[model samples]
Target: MKIAYTVAPGRGDTDLLLFGLSRCLLEKDVRATGVVQINAARDDAGPCDMDVKVLPDGPVIRISQSLGREARGCRLDPTALERAVGLVETRLAASVDCLIVNKFGKHEAEGRGFRTAIAEALSADIPVLVGLNRLNAEAFHKFSGGLATELPPNIEDLACWMTSVTAAKSSTA
Candidate 1:
């Protein structure tokens, strides 16, 4: 079954939560793959853009670039995002226990972004954990056909869900 966690809109901690949860799972030896967004460091005191880093210290790809001195107008690189999705697909084919996608945002809602990758993982019967917000909750519901579970931004809750799902999968195996 597919599962997702929804963070409230404007709550800027989704990325951090994903990263932390992935780290926790890694410590327990769960095989997972996906990209997580990290804040870019500025040298000359300018606006910082976001970078997508493959989990567990893989390559970092710049997904957004600062449009101007203001940090408000960052532009997402479509090519970079596509490349990231491709990488995730490759990982999914390698038989991971779970997939941790960064978010099911605008592109996913419109059948873009990592939508195909998400579907591929589900088809492989791999549990997926993705970030979602109120804005895209309806779209996600429609896309997931009500099979997705909305999880709060709590590590314990996420861990518990993961444990249950993985346990069930193992039993069936």
Candidate 2:
């Protein structure tokens, strides 16, 4: 299943969640891929250089609008949010089977919220799994219609989950 693993700011560990899900799906032979952040200003390094294809978080229009709002000391206009949402939607179209929106990656410009992107994702025919901190796994499962799975806290948990997915799929098949 194509699952969009998103998180809120200080919500949870996105890196771990993405890595875990990727490993799980791969072990299950589910043809998994990912879209993550790439630091445009820095040399290619870290996960960006990993097997997963990385993309820039914000494009020129969003950046320009954001900068304009900051300079004017005004709140982010709906136009900016719409443009930002459009950027994400466009990337998601031909990008991955699902979107793992890094909602917590950065703060929103005033009047902007991660919901903009989430709403767009919801409109698509993909499953979205939001990661949250403090909330128990059960809550997540409930929110995601039991499609949600707990994120691993360490390498061991990650490996186990991957193995489980693989085994489950194998048995069912």
- Judged by TM-score, which candidate is best? 1
lDDT of 1 by residue, 82-126 (tens): 888888888777857787878888888989988988888788777
Model 2 superposed RMSD (Cα): 8.6
Mark the regions of model 1 whose C-alpha exceeds 4 Å error after superposition: 8-10, 41-47, 70-74
- Pairs that collide in candidate 2 are none
* CA RMSD of each candidate after superposition: 2.0, 8.6
Worst 10 residues of 1 by lDDT: 65-74
Error of 1 at 133 (Å): 2.0
Output the number of the lDDT-best candidate.
1
Q: Total clashes, candidate 1?
A: 0
Q: Roughly what TM-score does model 2 have, to 2 decimal places?
A: 0.37
